[model samples]
Target: MTEARSNIAPVLRYAAMRRIRSFEERVGELFLRGQSAGSMLHLSIGEEAVVGMTDAMAPGDTFTTHHRGHGVFLARGADPARMMAEIAGKESGYCRGKGGSMHIADRALGHLGANAIVGGGIPHVVGAGLTYRNRRSGQISVAFFGDGAMSQGILYESMNMAALWHLPVIFCCINNQYGMGTRVDRSAGKLGFGGRAEAFGLIAAHAEGQEVEAVHHAARDLVAAARDGRPGFLEIDAYRFYGHARMDKSPYRSPEEEAEGRARDPLTTARARLAAEGLADAADLDRIDAAAAVEMDAALEADVAAAPPGLPTMFQDVYAPGTPAPRPQADRLRAVLSEAPR
Candidate 1:
C-alpha cells in the first residue's frame, strides 16, 4: 500500500490541469447532447490551480466548494465515474442521483459537498472546524467560495466566529473578475477580499490562481497555520473561461476582456512551464492527455449505462427514519370532510 512515486512538480501540475480540462470539455459536450440532469452546470475550466492546492492538504482536512467545483473534487481524488454518474442522475451517483453537479459530496475524501446557494457552504466549514476542535481531531476545514459570495453576510459571520474561537478554517476565494456576469467591482466594494478577512483578525494570503505551484505554496502555508488551530483567508486572482452557468454566453463581458482571459489559459501555461524546465517532453504530455481521455470516456460510458433512481427512493432519503411526511393538502381536506357531519 505504498503511495506511488511522484512526478516532477511542473509535469504533475500539467497532468492535473489537463485531466480537468478534458473532463470539463466532455461534460460540456454531454450537456449539449442533453445528457446531463439539471439546467445548472458550472465548469471550472480555467481554474485548475484552485484544484492544485489539493496537493497541500492533509488526509483529515475537510473542504466545501462552490457550484463550479468539479476540478476541486477531481483534484481531491473523487472517482471520475461516480462524478459523471451524479451529473447524469444515475442511481450510482454520490447522492443517489439526487444532488447532481452542484451537491457532489464524498465524506471519505473530506469533501463535504458543493453548494449551489451563494455563500451557503461558508458556515458549514465553520461548523466542521468547531467539530474538529471539540473532537481534538487536529483537522482543518477549508471553504471555497467565489468572489460573488464576498458580499454575503454569512461569510462575514463565519469569519468572525472562526477568528473569535481560533477555529481551523480557511476561506479560499476564487476572484474570477466576474460574478455571474457582474464585474467584481460592481458587486464587492473597493476593499480587497483578503483585506476584508484581515479586518476580522485572521491571517490572509494572496496568490495567483493561474500558477499551480504558486497556489500550492500559498495553500501549504495557510493550511499549516489552520492545522495549528488558527483561521486563515486566501484570495486567488483567476479568470473563468466560460460564463457563470451552462446557458450563459457572457453577454455582459466585452470581447476584449474575453479574449484576454482566454489567453491566460492555465493548462497552456503549465505545459509551457513543464517544457521550459525540461521536466517532460511533448510525448510524455500527450500520453498523459491520452490517459485522461480514456479514463473520462469510460466514466461517461458508465454514467450513461447506469440506471436511474426508483420512485420509492425519492421519499427514502428525504425524511428521517420512521418519520411520516405530511399528507397532501387534497388528501387532508378529503379526510377532514369525511370526518365532518357533511
Candidate 2:
C-alpha cells in the first residue's frame, strides 16, 4: 500500500472503510447467531477510520492493537473468512481457534498481537522500537489503544521510555468518547488527550474520525516523522456507535447523544466525500458496498461451517512442544489402577 493517503485512490479508501463496516456488521450477526466464541466481543463499528493509519504504515512496520481491533487488522490485510473463523472458535482460525476475537494476530502481517487488557499492548511496541533502533532497521512500531488507556501508568511509562530513548514508535489512542459507559470528559482531567502526550516530549496530533481523509493525512506526516527516530502520538476522536460489548445496551448515554454521534459516521461521511468530489458516484459506491456485503456473508458462512478443534486437541497450543504435558485425570486414574493390583 501507499505510504501516503494521496497515493491511494479515493475509491480504495472508501472501499477500506466500507469493508471494515461490513465485517463488523457480520461480527454482530455472528454473535446473534450464537457462533461467536464468547459474549465479550468488542466491535469497532463507528471507529472504522482508524484504518487510515494503516494506510500510512509501510511494509515491515509493526503494530499491536486494542481489543476493538478487527477492522484495523482487516485493513492491514487479514482474511475475513479466517478472521470470522477465529472469532467463532473454529479449527480453521488464525490461531486454530485459540485467540478468539480480542486476540487475533498475524505475525507475518507485523501484528504482534491484540491485547485484551486496556493498556497491555502499548508497551510491546516500545520493546520492538528499541530493537529497531539498535539494529538501524528503519522500521517503526505502533501501539493502538483506546482512550481508556490514557490513565494507565503503563502507557505513560511506555511513552516516557520511547521519548527518552528516541525509539521509533507511535502510540495512537482511539478515543471513541466512552470508556465503558464513563464518558471521556468525565474520566480524564485533561480533555484533548494529545496535550498529555505532548508533555512526554513526543510529537502529538489530533483528528476527527468523521473525516477519514483528514485523519489519513495527519497520520502520513506523523508516521514519516516516527520513522525518522522521533516518536509520535495521535488521538482520533470517534464515536462508539453501539455499546462497549455485544450485550451492552449503552443505557448511560441518551438517544439524542447517540443519534448525534451516529450522524457523524465516518463510513457514511467518506462515501459522501467520494461522491461530492466526483472521485466516485452513487452507483459506484453502492456496488462497492454490495460487494462488501457479499464478501462478509460468505465469511460468516465459512465461520459457521468450520469445525471446532475438538477434545483430542484441547491441550495442543496450551503447552510447548518437546515438553511433557500434565496427565489428564482419567489417564492418571487408569495408571493408578493398573499399578495397584495385579
Candidate 3:
C-alpha cells in the first residue's frame, strides 16, 4: 500500500506531462500536414502543472476548461484514443468529431466541456455549482480560464454570485502572461490576478504554477475549502511556450520572453521535485515516459487511419427531441419580410 500510494503521484504527473506534450506536438504536425481542420490550435506547452493539480482533485468534481484544455481533459482521465481521434476529426471523438480540441467533453468524468470563446465557460461552471447545491450533492465545480479572461464581465459576475450563494466552486485562473497578442500588463489594470477575486469576498490563493508540488498543495487546500461549501479562487502564475494560436506570430513577445518562459518548464520541474523528495526515482519517471510514448504513438496511428464524419449526419444532433425541422427558405424570406416592414 505504501509503495502503491507513493507511486501514484509520479505516474500521474508523468502522464499529464506526456499527454500534453505529445498531443500538442502531434496536433501541430497534423496541422502542417494538412490533415487537421477548424480554428487555429493553441498548444499548452510549459504549463502542465495546472493539469497535474487537477489530477489531485476528487473524481466526481467537475471543471470547465479553456481553449488550451487538452491537458485538463487528459488529467481528468479522458481517453487519449478518443481525444486524438477528436483532434483528427474522426467519428469516434467525444462529440462524434463535431467538437474538436476546444470543445471536448466527457460527462462521466465530470468534464462539463472546454469552450473556444474566451471566458465563455465561467457562467457554465457557476450553473454546475448551483445544480450541485440545489441537488444537495457534495461535488465541487471548477472554472479554469486564462488571465486574459479576467477582463470579461461574466467572470466577475460569476465570482459575485458564487461568493454570495456560498457555492462549492473554485475559480482557477491560469495567468499565462498574455491574452493573444496583448500582455497581461497591457490588458489588466491589476497586475496580481488572484487579488481581483477578493472584491467578491472569495478566499483566493496564488502559487508557482510551474511547480507541480506547489500547484498540487494549493489546489488540494482550495478544493477542501470548496467542498466545505466555501467558494475559493486560485491564480496559477504559469506560461505557455507556444503562440496564442497557430496563425499567431507572437510579435508582441520577444525571443528573450520565450527563453525566460522556457527556463521554467513544468515537466522538468515536476520530475526534479519528485526525485529530490524521494517520492520517485529517475528510472520510475523514465518508465512512465516510455509508457506514455507508447500510448501516444498508438493513438496517433489510430487517428491517422480514422475517417471524418459523414455529410448526411451533419444536422443529426442539433435539436432536442421532437423539435420541428428548420426551414431555411422560410427563415430567409422572414428576414427579408421583417426588414421591409409590411
Top TM-score hit: 2
* Candidate 3 residue lDDT tens string, 164-206: 9989999999888889989888998769867779889888988
Q: Tell me the tens digit of each residue's lDDT in model 1 across 1-342.
A: 012324476576677788888889888877998989977899988888886577788887899999988988888888888999899888998889999999999999999999999899999999999999898898999999889899899999999999999899999998887788898988866857888999999999887877887888888898988888889999888899998888999999888998899787777777777766667766777899999999998888888889999866766756777899655567789989999985
Q: Please, what is the whole-model Cα lDDT of each candidate in the order they appear?
A: 0.86, 0.90, 0.82
Positional deviation of residue 73's Cα in model 1 after best superposition, in angstroms: 0.9
| Runs of candidate 3 exceeding 4 Å displacement | 1-7, 327-342
TM-score of 3: 0.91
**Which residue runs of candidate 2 sit more than 4 Å off their true CA positions?**
1-8
Count backbone clashes in candidate 1: 0
Better of 2 and 3 by lDDT: 2
Error of 1 at 18 (Å): 1.7
- Lowest lDDT sum, 10 consecutive residues, model 1, at 1-10
Clashing pairs in 3: none
Error of 1 at 314 (Å): 0.9
